[model samples]
Target: MNAVLIALLALPLLGAALMLAPIGDRQALRLGATVTGGTLLLAVALAAGFDHGDPGRMQAVTDVSWIPALDVRLHLGTDGISLPLLVLTALLTFLCALYSVKKLPAGPGGRAFTGLLLLLETGMLATFAVLDLVLFFLAFEIVLIPMYFLVSRWGSGKKTAAANRFILYTLLGSAVMLLGFLLIGVKAGTFDMVKLADAHGAGLSHTTQLVAALAVLVGLAVKAPAWPLHSWLPDAHTAAPTVGSVLLAGVMLKMGTYGLVRVLLPVVPDGTATFAPYLGAFAAVGIVYGSLACLALARAGAKGDLKRLIAYSSVGHMGFVLLGIASLTPTGLNGALFANIAHGLITGLLFFVVGAVKDRYGTADLDTLSGATGAALYGRAPRIGALLAFAAVASLGLPGLAGFWGELLAMYGAFDPAAGLSRPAFVTYMVLAGLGTLLTAGYLLIVVKRVCMGDPKQPAPVAELPDLQAHEAVSWTPLAALTLLAGLWPALLLGLSDPAVKHLLGGG
Candidate 1:
């Protein structure tokens, strides 16, 4: 088990290293796909071997002392909580690699692009695997460098500025988070996540725990980019290339929310209780804010970029996740976890479709691409249009899709919060969140009507353009299928998470 886990981390690094060996672009692409594919297989094996009945306990643990003086160990493990994310990281990275095989970003360094992607995969996988706070922090920070390079080097307009903003915001957040970790580490005399969470910061004074929790929550909220802090996301997504947007929305955003469930709630229960109401408020506000932003952009006629609008939609989806976390009930946490995976599949697919739109039409301009106004995309590229509509509907939380359960359950949690929480406050949040759902439906339907429904105003040259290329079909089919499968069988993911969440919340 230990060997398999180590191999999962090592394979990506090895692939990255090989990219430096004077490899040609074709070979580099091949190597990237091969490495990520292998990693995905390993992730699957890990899941197959997981003891689902005992998922509350970490499985395949590999613990060894690495820094004796500091009481930090080289611990790696996964529970039901981390397993889904682990698989998500592997699956998305592999798909990105496959997508790059034919549609490599317009950049000079194909080798560097593939290499950095592999490295990014390593950091993401490691972040979920590590069970030591210090090691987790290290793995968490490792992803920033490669992603910064990815955005700055390969992105479009104002890429450098966007990259700088992303780095500044995340680095500051991470620094504050580190301080919180250090405070708990010093007080507990160890950085083992399992021990710290089990203790629930019992060793620290109430005031100390509260202070540390504030610092940690603030830091994570920034990464989660809850409301005011989320300004960086739009620009970053707008400037980023297709694959960058896919991974950023699909995998990176989950890191902050994952920390909330994995680190904050368990390690500092008192702190989480103290701040839960306020967290719920912020989440509710973000939901409305994100939806309104999308509506305003949609109203902007030809000026709005589809990619940026999708980025705003992400903020709204994440608000549901945050609301679930703030509820701090087993049902809420389950919803949050389910939403995490659903967002990855649905939004990742959305980004891919948007990227293809831009690639084929030279822009993701709504008025220009809208079938009602310009190209009549459904008539020109029927397959791409159909796929885009499917992704958008799923994202809007349509019935019988992956996005439905999470939002529905989250609202339910807010309606009936945990035992100790304030009922009035959560009910208010529930109402607000319910309204946000209406807004979500409104904006998405508007987009669909404009882009997919109307007759061709000025039909694009069908012969020159293509719809759902071979590589794209290969990369997208699994996500589309899973969205339906999980929707129909919510238990597939919910079952895995319920026991673990129950254990965390002391329901066991």
Candidate 2:
């Protein structure tokens, strides 16, 4: 079991290291696909062997002393909370790698790009696996440089600025978060997350918990891009390349929210309690704001950049995730966990579809792609249009798709909240989130109507545009199928998470 966990981290790192050798474009692509494919298989095996009957306990733990003087250890493990995210990280990376094999945005697509992607994969996988605060922080920071390079080097419009803002904002947040982690470690006399969670703030004073929680939450929120802190996301997502966008939306944002549930909620329950109301308020604001922003973009027609609009939608989607975490109820946490995985699949597919659109039309501007009457997509490429529509509806939380269950469960959690939380406040948040969903449906439906329902102004040229490519079909099918599967059978995720959420919250 430990070997599986170790290999989960090592295979990608080794693949990345091997990428440093002189490799051609095709070789690099194949290598990346092969490595990520193996990683995905390992993740599946991890899930297969996971003690679902005892998901509350961390399994596949790999603990050893890495630095004796400081008592830091190379600790790693997973529970239901982390396991889904681990698999999600692997699955998305593998899909992206497969996509890259045939399609890379116009840039140097060989060794450097593939290597950075593998390195990024290593960090993300490690972030979910590590059980030591020091190691967790290290894993958290490891992704920044590679992602930065990917955006700046391979991305399109405003790439440099986007990458710069991403690095700067996240780096500042990480610095603050590290200080908080050190504070917790020093005061608690240990850095083991499992132990800290078990103690549940027993050794720490309220003041210390309060202070540390603020620092850590602020840092993680920046990554979560909660409310005002989310300014970097739209530009970053819009500017990043296709695979970059997929990975960013699909996997990276969850890191912040995952930290909230796994570390903040479990390790500093009191502090999280104190901040829950404010967090819920901010999350509520983000939900309405993101929906409204996407609504405006949707109405803008040609002026709207599809990629940027989807990025804003992420803000709203992640807001629901935050709202769930802030609720601090078993149902809410379960909802958060489920929402995390759903967003990864649905949004991943959305970006992939958008990437395909951009690849065909050379732009993601709604008007350019949609044509004068706002209906070139279906005419030009019916299959791709349908794919886009499917992804959009799924993202809007349609009833039978992956996106529906998470938001629904999250709202259900907010309706009652936890014992200590203000029911009235949470109910208000819930109301606003519900409104956000309506607005979400409005915008997404408008997008589908405008882009996929109308006829093309220039039928000849539009009809000449290609439909879904083989690589795209291969890359997108799993996400689409899983979205429907999870939506129709939400218990698949909820069951795995419920016990873990209970245990994290002291087995309530």
Candidate 3:
């Protein structure tokens, strides 16, 4: 089992190295698909063998001294909190790799694209798997390089500027986060996450925890792209290729929220308790802000870019995730984890569908897509239109979909936050979050109406648009299916995460 964990990390790195050898573009793509597919199988195996009875226990752990002098170890493991995200990373990467095989982005062939993607996978998987703070930071930072290249090289509009902004903002965040980690390591006497979490701020002073929490949370908020810090996401997502956008929304943003749960909460209980209200406040603001932004985009019609609207929607969705964490309760944490996975699937599929639309029409503008008049898509491409509508409904938190449970649980948790947090503040946040949901439904329904419900009276070029293709179907079906499955059986994820959440909040 330990070997399985190591292989999960090493396999993709090895495959990416092999991609550098002289090979045909087609062969490179095939190799990428095979490699990521194998990685996904390994993730499934880990899940199958995971001890559901003790989901809180770290399984398949690989701990060894990497720097004896500094007491830093090369530690890797997964608990219920991380297991779902690990599998999600693997599944999405494999699907993206498979999708790229058929629909390689322009400006680069299979070699550059596949290699960068595989490397990005390695970073993302390691971020969810590592147990040492130093190792975690390193893994988190490794993702930037490949992603920067992906956007600048293969992206569409303002690619260079977007990539530069993305890297600069995240790098600054990483720097501040590293400062927090160093403060903890120097004061706490070690950098091992397990030890720190077990101690639960025993040795650290109240002041240290407060400062560390502020710095760490700020850094992560930048990546979570929380309200004020989220300016980079829209441009980056709009410019990136389909696979790039999928991985960015589906996996990368989770790194920030995951760090909050896996590192901040247990490791800095005092700070988390003190700042819980503020976190909830900011989360509420982000929720409303993101929804309003999307509403503006949806109403833009021809001026709107579907990809950009989806990017704004992520801010609102991730706000719910942060809100869950802020509640600092077991149910809230579970909701955060559940929302993380749900967003990955629904948003990944949405990006894929939008990417397909852009491929057909050469733009994602609503009016141009539907025609100068209304109701052009249903006539031109019923399948794509239907897929868009389905994804939109799933994203809007419909009762029987994956999105509903998480937001519901998050708001419920806010209605009753942890013992020390102020009830009034949280209740206010809850009310605002609920309003954000209504706004969310409004914008998404607007999108469905404008993009999918139009008549079949489109012009000749619009009529010529192709329906969903085989490769697109293969890549997108799993996400749609899992969205429905998880929606109907919320316990599939809640079961794995509930115990772990309890243990984390209970101080191990």
Model 2 residue runs over 4 Å out of place are 457-463
Q: What's the lDDT of the predicted structure labeled candidate 2?
A: 0.92
TM-score of each: 0.98, 0.98, 0.99
Off by over 4 Å in 3: 300-302, 460-463
Per-residue lDDT tens digits of candidate 2, residues 36-131? 999999999999999999989989988899999999999989988899899999999999999998987677767888999999999999999999
Count of clashes in candidate 1: 0
Roughly what TM-score does model 3 have, to 2 decimal places?
Answer: 0.99
lDDT of 1 by residue, 224-248 (tens): 8688788889999998999999999
Q: For every candidate structure, what is the RMSD over all alpha carbons to the true structure, in angstroms?
A: 1.5, 1.2, 1.0
Displacement of the residue 344 alpha carbon in candidate 1, Å: 0.3
lDDT for each candidate structure:
0.89, 0.92, 0.92
